[model samples]
Target: MNPLYISQKLFEHYEHIEEVKHYYGLLAIYALLLTAEEKQDPVLLGKCKTVLSRFPDHIQHPRYNFPSYRIGGIPKAYSLMKDYLPEAEEQVRYYAEEMLTASRDRKGIMSYPYAPEKELIWIDVAMAVTPYLLFAGLALGDEKYIDEAAKQTFLMYEEFLDQENGLLHQSKNWAGPGKYSEDHWGRGNGWGYLPLAELVQHLPQHSRHRTKAEKYFKDLSASLLPYQSERGLWRQEIPFEYAYEETSGSGLILYGMGVGMRTGLLDREKYFPAFKKGIEALNQICINADFSTERSCPGCLCPGDGEEKGTVKAYVTLMLPHRDEHHSFAPLMFALVEAYRNGIYDLPRDSH
Candidate 1:
């Protein structure tokens, strides 16, 4: 029941695969970086480097696909690997600058800002793209990147956040019949949550933006906590019986919560149990079940069709029949790492 042991199984599953080249690749690369950091293993770092090597200059690499801002985290992965590889810094700066310039030109949004169209803002992009924004800002002693991050973060918050429930919709529609999904998709919430937690993690502690981000984190945590089921996992549609408990949402939410606990961003008394409960749930659902991840929406554009109205029915029906979905792999491994880092719970076994 070693967490690392379990994580290795998931990592090895993606080790040789090359078909995925978008968010999955970006997430897998970031997950590998986190794994390398946690293990402090050169061999693991080398493995991460191998992933980066696949796209040598991510800035110009046609495959990396710029202006999506999914490419933001990719540069951080490159920067992290700089110690192990010589050209890492150059690559990091290049992509970071290019992504910033592209967003600037696009009026501060990803190229694929929304589903089935453009200029619309996806809630997930806050997490998908902002890490590098905050990171590059801090790394280069440039408030511009950090400022951009805060602007985008707050904009997404302004657009998608439902302050009434402290929940969020999937995307903001620039031009559409329906602006966004009606239901609060669990994984979508996770996407929003993780970025705020990440801002708390990476930004200067006393900065006004960090303080605001922390408040946002706590408020969202308060909002999301009630939805956790008796099984300690959140469902696809969140607190809805129509859909089953999902792994990717659970993992992303769990990772953010665990990191919040570790960083003191979340209240220990209120959240530790929730965090521990999530890990236990994951152990029961995924770790012991041959690393199976159930109920994952396997990487598709949500609300992709005009017919697929953003309803609870649409959400539950489409986000189903999950089995070994690779989309779940990164977040689960991420949660595993953060669980280890937080030390709230150990491996499922009595002894790791």
Candidate 2:
């Protein structure tokens, strides 16, 4: 089957499960819509409507019980389906503004007041919030929100970036106060790449701001290049001393590089091998036709550090064991779409 077919079939089964955070499923909806649009498949287009209908008007965050990534997904879905669902135009447009009002601070950057411990700068903030904000801004004909998306993206990078290495730390104050952790968790890198790549794609042509995002994308790509394992995968803990080879983050990197290659932001000769290696790594997934176990990084938090509070870990034990989970599948869905578009898989290479 073609990748879109396989991904659609997989997510069709997974989306029905009642997860606390439907953001992953919500994102999957956008992926399906984009794929449908690209392939011009009316069947997939119709499914987008059905899948989006499952979300509530006021999509609540699973943990915080507030508007968040769930709500952000609305404008993205709406942008793709607005013509067909013309009646929903006003409602969806208004909800986009509502999202910014609900989560933004004085500077229009994200501020989750009720979060468990006041995590103002999670790396995933860039991923979960920026694209929706950009699409919402465009859907509503408001450039302000677009500016916020760009501003917030760079701000998040400033806060989370591991300056020395270029990849991002998960968050500024994840473990506790009076401490800062620099562990470059793999998925944390995914969070950064997903948003940066999407923002770069949507940026206005000839705007200097587009160049700003492109610089960040290029720098991050260079930073991560040295870490890609010989197997074409990045590890859960990034450094070889800490954890096992992983999939989700690797998929995310592939997606970002694919986007960069398409946009001419990444050089073909320099990044092509890295992109090819990622596909080779993904082909190693032992996906059973019957949905058995497979290799993937489990959801992770900042590894607590006893030795240095939060700055460094004596032994980062938070690297969760691999399993068949959304972390792996979500980005892989994105990677396949990117690969199909970029012809990464079609490039001649020896089969694994």
Candidate 3:
């Protein structure tokens, strides 16, 4: 089936689920709306906003029940909706501003008081939170959020990037010295790519960190492109051989690269091959008729320092495991829309 049909089907199902912060249905909603060929549907957009509005400005940290991870990506979600819903824009913007101020501190390594201490902390806190703050800055046009993202991005690289190899290790102090040491996780790299690529595109050309952001975008793309498996997906662990192809990392990389190509940060000729490979891999998942559209990889606490967990098990145990629950619709929606945007899936002509 075509991606739009898949999205509509998911939306119908989502209508029955209780709206919650972590449901992340908005990610899919935005993808579906953004990719439609026709004029913007006000009603559909309103429905998205209504669901998103249910998310409070901040959630109690799951581990600490404190205010950590407050920089959730609600601002970016609202930013996407605001152009069509100006009346509702204020409310969204208000929430965005509140988050920015609430999380800001001018000292070393600004962060939420509530960064989760879970075993899977790397994925949830590091990867998930980065995009939220980056988008919050872009949507609100605020310096503080942008600065926080930049700082965290740099800090993550500093702390987790292994000197021996260029890839990001999954968490801080993960493996024994030099034994499977500092091996990159596909999703962790994917997590790093999204914000830097998008934030650099959105931030002012002359922002103080513009050069650093550019280097980051270039380095991440270069390091990751070589790892694409012949089957057109990345392995869960970069150095692991013949691992299963994963959708969530593929989608994140696809979206990041497509955005990079769209905004001119990435070279089309150099990168489009990888983009095509990832898109084809993701589309293959759709053709497989798998209901669970996302495959979870190992989750991390600090980069290079924790055990890897899968998607399904994490959700069931409410604790991190090497491999468990599926992230579900995020990778599918993100990849489908990005595939359409990049002309990889031959979306109808009007979609362009």
Candidate 4:
């Protein structure tokens, strides 16, 4: 099947579903924005404006209202929509300033500002906040916003990255203070890696931070290579051979790798085989005939309690994959769009 056609069908599938106001919903919207831009489809772009217009103001979810989580894709959406939507500039600026003043730990890392482990920080914040701020900075022409965007990711990298393996732990303080989650969860790695990919791909070439972001992106990509399953996906518990192949994380990783290859940060000769295998496998297994997706892990954040919390065992056991989960849609779209951009039109012949 054609990747672009598949992506459009998938977006249509999402449009029929109930409105999702959380990060996952925003992620799908972000994917649509990217797809429309890449394809230069004015109709799809109009759809983006219409979908975004549904959320005129950020509606706080009764739960999951952490500052970083709330910011989600608003900045990118704002950057893309500002010219079209009159209020886009104001909405993005509001969130950008909010992020600047959000709570943080003594190390200057942003933290969830609430009771019950308020000091906690995690890799997920990279996806939640980094790109948002980057877009905001670029849009507003504010160096301060741009600097904070780079700083957040760098600080998280310092705290969560496992230097020995080059894979990152999901979060800190979820297990206990000054401790890190045991498993290098697939989505967690994607969350960490994607923003750096964004930074490298979008940052001005002369920006002082681009080199460091590239290094981090390249290192994580190299480290993840050995862990890719023979089937071209990464497992839920990435290093664990027995864990199930997961598409959400795999899609995010593939998207980043595609960005790396496109920008010449990753060598096509070295990475293309894995990329080809992954996109092919994604089309073959994860996406259904109707373009509904499956096998993407559902919403998961340091699951479990007591002894099981933050353990690799819990990561593999507690976070089960489900059909048509919200998290799955965007990653699949992201991978497919990147694949299309890289001139991968169809699945491998053997896949057929």
Best by TM-score: 4
TM-score for predicted model 1 compared with the true structure: 0.86
lDDT of 4 by residue, 1-352 (tens): 6687778778788767756557777877788778887888999888877777656455545466445344345534344434655556766778788888987888988887774345888888878888888887888778888899899998898788888899999888877787778989999999998889889988889999998999999999999988989889998989899999998999999999999999999999999999999998898889887777888888777888998899998888888998788898888998999999998987532222
Model 4 bad stretches (over 4 Å): 57-61, 64-72, 75-86, 116-118, 348-352
Write the residue-wise lDDT of candidate 3 on 116-140 in tens digits: 2211123223444445556656666
By lDDT, the candidates rank as 4, 1, 2, 3
Candidate 1 residue-wise lDDT at 194: 78
Q: For model 1, what is the C-alpha lDDT against the true structure?
A: 0.69
Per-candidate Cα lDDT values, in order, are 0.69, 0.66, 0.55, 0.82
The residue ranges of model 3 lying beyond 4 angstroms of the native Cα positions read 1-20, 23-26, 29-33, 36-39, 57-72, 75-77, 84-124, 173-183, 286-291, 298-326, 345-352
TM-scores of all candidate predictions against the true structure: 0.86, 0.85, 0.72, 0.94
lDDT of candidate 4 at residue 142, scale 0 to 100: 85
- CA lDDT, candidate 4, residue 338: 96
Model 1, span 127-228: residue lDDT tens: 766776776666666777787777777667667777678888776553354366676888888888877877888878677687788878888888888989
**lDDT of model 2 at residue 339?**
72
